[model samples]
Target chain A: MIDLLYFAWVRERIGLPRERVETGAATVAELVEELRAREERYALAFADLSSLRVALDQELAEFDAPLAGVREVAFFPPMTGG
Target chain B: MRVLVQAAPFDFGAEAQAFADGAAGAGAIVTFTGLVRDLSGALTAMEIEHYPGMTERAIAAIAEEARQRWHLIDALAIHRHGRLRPAEPIMMVATAAVHRAEAFAAAEFLMDYLKSRAPFWKKEVTAQGADWVAARDADEAALGRW
Candidate 1:
């Protein structure tokens, strides 16, 4: 099982902050595809991939990055920190 | 180096003094504080959200990079999350080095990275409603200079 987390508008849209899901997806992109196909809310939150950012196990990563030993995945828009 | 991600307010004056005092050999210290902007007078508060585990890790990495690149004697960053009233301080960064030039440059570098690279999101709350603050292209561009 992989832990999925969301923040900001993504969390608002998804209606929850975190969840555990069991999946066989090989990469972050595949995992996203699986999520987008699960329901309308997921589809809407991930409608535009270009506007989103992803992190694997607390580190920023690319969509195509493999998720072999990854345990946590976060999805959110570009950060406005400082 | 010290990185603090907290929900409570911090004393900037005291933090700067402590950081400076800790760096006995340092000749220069630069500190920058960021406050929530009211702008049009409609903003009631600013809500900041951050990834818990990632926030600290990301900041420590940034601070370490600054320390190595500038050969800083010491550095400190404090960022506040949760609801913040207009004009309230949102965050602060301080850098100490052997000279003024290095201290100033490192502080700027830390600010630039913290703006875009850190994992914090901000929302502006006005009397009318609350809205997420979109990331600006200029902020992303600022990173290119470094």
Candidate 2:
């Protein structure tokens, strides 16, 4: 099992801050697709990948990044930090 | 270099003084503090959320970059997460160098990186409702300069 985390609006939509997911996906994009199929909230939150950012194992990564040994994944909207 | 990510409010004056005092070999010290702007009085409060482990790591990486590009004696970055009010200090970056130009440039570089690359999100709450502040394209473009 891997840890899946959400922040900001993604957290609001998914209604959970974090979860343990057991998946067979090979890439982050495939994992996202798996999540989208699980619930409508995930589908809605992930409708637009351009507006979202993803982190794999605490590092920023692309959707097509390999998830073979990744332990944690976080999804969130574009950061507005200062 | 030092990076602090906390939820409690920080004292800008004391922190600035401390940073300045600790830079023994520096001739110039610069500090920049970001305040919550409540323009038009529509904003009641601001809520900042951040990724726990990534927040500190991202900030430290930015500080490291600044140190490499400039002749800095020391540098510190402090950012707060959670509820903040209008005019409250949201974050501060302090840089010390042998000259004013290096200090100023490093501080600006740190600010630009913090605004774009850091994994922090802010939401503005007003009497009408609340909304997540959109990330400005200008911020992303600003990073390309360095």
Candidate 3:
């Protein structure tokens, strides 16, 4: 089980902030693809990866990075907080 | 070091006084407060959103980096989340150092880092609808130069 968090417009699009997701994937990109396949909301939320940022275990990472042992994955729009 | 991320607005004068209350060694206290601008009142309101745990972690990291860069005695950063109207105070940074230069520099540095590095997004509610302010390339460039 992995905790997936969404923020900003991503949260609005996904209609959630966090969720316990079950996935059989080796990389963050695969997980994203799996999510995108689940529903239209996920599709829209993950549609534009260029404008989104990802974090694995609270460290910034690219979507293609391996997620073999990662416990958490967070997706959010371009960080506007300062 | 005190780092706060909340949805409710904060009191600047009170926060500043509390930080400098009993610190006799500190010779200078510098502070910066960011308010929601009118911008022609085009934006009647704004909603600030942020990731929960991640938001706090990012702000803490920025504060830690600032402390390492400057000779800071005490530092504080408070940012509000959720919905806010125009002219509201969005954020505040306070730095105390032995000299004015260090205090000023650290405070400014913290603000700059927070603006670019922090994981917060704002959506302006105007007459039409909600719009996310595009992350300024200039802001990102500013962060890179630091």
Candidate 4:
């Protein structure tokens, strides 16, 4: 199980802040592909990988990175915190 | 103690005092408070939106990364969400270390990471309409240099 989080327009597109996802994917890219396959909403949210940032297990990572042993994956627009 | 995310405005003096008050044998406390500037030539009220739980976790990770990369004794990062007025405090970072160099360097590092790595997004509302501002190349370059 992994806690998937969405922020900003991604959250608006998915209509969810967070969700518990069960997956058998081997990499972050595969997981995103699975999510995109689920519905048009997910497809729209994950359409452009360049516009989004990903964190695995609370650490920033590339989309193609492996997801093994990861407990959390968060997706958000490029940060504007500071 | 290391991270806090909220929508309410924060008092800089009080927060710095509190952080300094909690420090143990620290000689320097460097703080950075970012204000909502009416972007040069732009008049807009910005609204910051964020993922509740994930935002905190991402910032904590950035703080932890800063701790690992610097000689720091303590660090605190607090950011505001929701609507914010021009010139209001948007975020603050305090880094306490044994000397001024570490404190200052860590403070800068923290802000750089916070700007590029955190999960908060901002939308500027002007007389025209609300438009979400995308991340700039400068921010990416800042993160890259680290």
Candidate 5:
């Protein structure tokens, strides 16, 4: 199981900030695919992979990053900080 | 280098002064304050959200890079999260160095990284409604120069 965190619009669409998911996915992309299959909300939030950014265990990572031993995964829109 | 991520309002003038004073033997001190700009009368407030631990770590790494690239005597970055009003200060970056060039460059670099690399997200609330601020391509491109 891993903590899945959503922020900003992703959170609004998913209607929750975070959740714990039990998965056997090998990569972040595989996990995304599993989540997308679970419900329509996840599918909508992740409809376009280009529009979303992911962080593995609090560090910016690519979708293909391995999830082994990872504890947290955050999905959000591109950062708009200053 | 020092990085502060908080929801509370910060005293810009006092913080800038203190940062400058703390850098012993530095001849140049440059500070940039980012304000929540509202051009239209409709804008009421801006809400900023961030991942706590990552926010601090990312900012500290950016500050460290600035310190390594420039001959800065000291550097400080302060960013605020949560609901904020127009004209309110959103963040500040200050750099102290022996020369103005290093101070200015480091401060600019800090701003650039803080915009794209940091984990904060912003939502702008107007009289009509609230919307998440879109990330700009220009912000991402700005990183290429450095």
Candidate 6:
């Protein structure tokens, strides 16, 4: 099981802050595809890949990055800090 | 280097004084504070959300980069999360260096990275409603200068 976290509007759209997903996906992109296929809320939150950023185990990563041995995945819009 | 992510309001004056005093050979110290702006006059508060573990790590990485690039004597970053009222400070960055140029540049670099690279999202709460502040393209462009 992979721990998934969502923030900002993605969390609002998905109706939760975090979840534990059991998946066999091989990469971040594949995992996104799996989530997108699950429901309409997931589809809407992930509809635009360009607007979203992803992190694997607390580090920024590309969509196609391998997820083997990864424990946490986060999805959110571009940061507006500072 | 010190990075703090918290919901409590920080004492800017005290922090600045402490930072300046702690720098052993710093010829210059630059500090920048970002405040919640009520541009529309209708804004009641700014809500900031951040990824718990990643926020600190990302900020530390940015500060580390600034230190290495500018040969900084020390660096400090403090960012607040959760609900913030207009005029309240949202974050602050301070850099100490042997020269004013390095201090200024390092502070700017830290701000630019913190704006785009850090995992913090801001939502403006106005009397009308609440909306997430969209990431500005200009902010991303600012990173190219580094």
For this target, which candidate reaches the highest DockQ against the unseen true structure? 6
Estimate every model's Cα lDDT from 0 to 1. Answer: 0.96, 0.95, 0.86, 0.87, 0.94, 0.97
TM-score of chain B of 3: 0.95
User: What are the per-model DockQ values?
Assistant: 0.96, 0.90, 0.71, 0.64, 0.91, 0.97
lDDT of 2 at B51: 98
lDDT by residue for model 3 over A2-73, one digit each (tens)? Answer: 999888788889998899989998998899899999999999999989988899988789988999889989
lDDT tens readout by residue for model 3, B3-51: 8999877889999899898456899999899998777668889888876
Tens digits of per-residue lDDT, candidate 4, A7-78, equal 788888999988998999999899999999999999999999998888887677999899888998988888
Q: Tens-digit lDDT track for model 5 on B1-146?
A: 88999999999999999998899989999999999989787789999999888999999998988998897899999999999999999999999999999999999999999999899999999978999999999999999999
lDDT tens digits, residue span B58-139, model 6: 9999999999999999999999999999999999999999999999999999999999999999999988889999999999
Off by over 4 Å in 5: none
Displacement of residue B10 (Cα, Å) in model 1 is 1.1
Error of 3 at A13 (Å): 2.1
Cα distance off (Å), candidate 2, residue B1: 1.6
Predicted candidate 2 versus true structure: per-residue lDDT over B6-45, tens digit per residue:
9999999999998988999999999999999988788999
State the fnat of candidate 4 relative to the true structure.
0.83
Chain B TM, cand. 6? 0.99
Deviation in angstroms for B136 in model 6? 0.5
Q: TM-scores of the first chain across all predictions?
A: 0.98, 0.98, 0.95, 0.95, 0.98, 0.98
Ordered by DockQ, highest first, the candidates read 6, 1, 5, 2, 3, 4
Provide the lDDT at A13 for model 4: 94
Q: Name the best candidate (by lDDT).
A: 6
Over A1-82, each residue of candidate 6 has an lDDT whose tens digit, in order, gives: 9999999999999999999999999999999999999999999999999999999999999999999999999999999999
Scored against the true structure, residue B146 in model 5 reaches a CA lDDT of 93
Give the least accurate 10-residue stretch of model 2 chain B, judged by summed lDDT. B35-44
Candidate closer to the true structure by TM-score (higher is better), 5 or 6: 6
After superposition, which runs of candidate 3 have C-alpha atoms over 4 Å from their true positions?
none
Off by over 4 Å in 6: none
How well does candidate 2 reproduce the true complex, by DockQ?
0.90
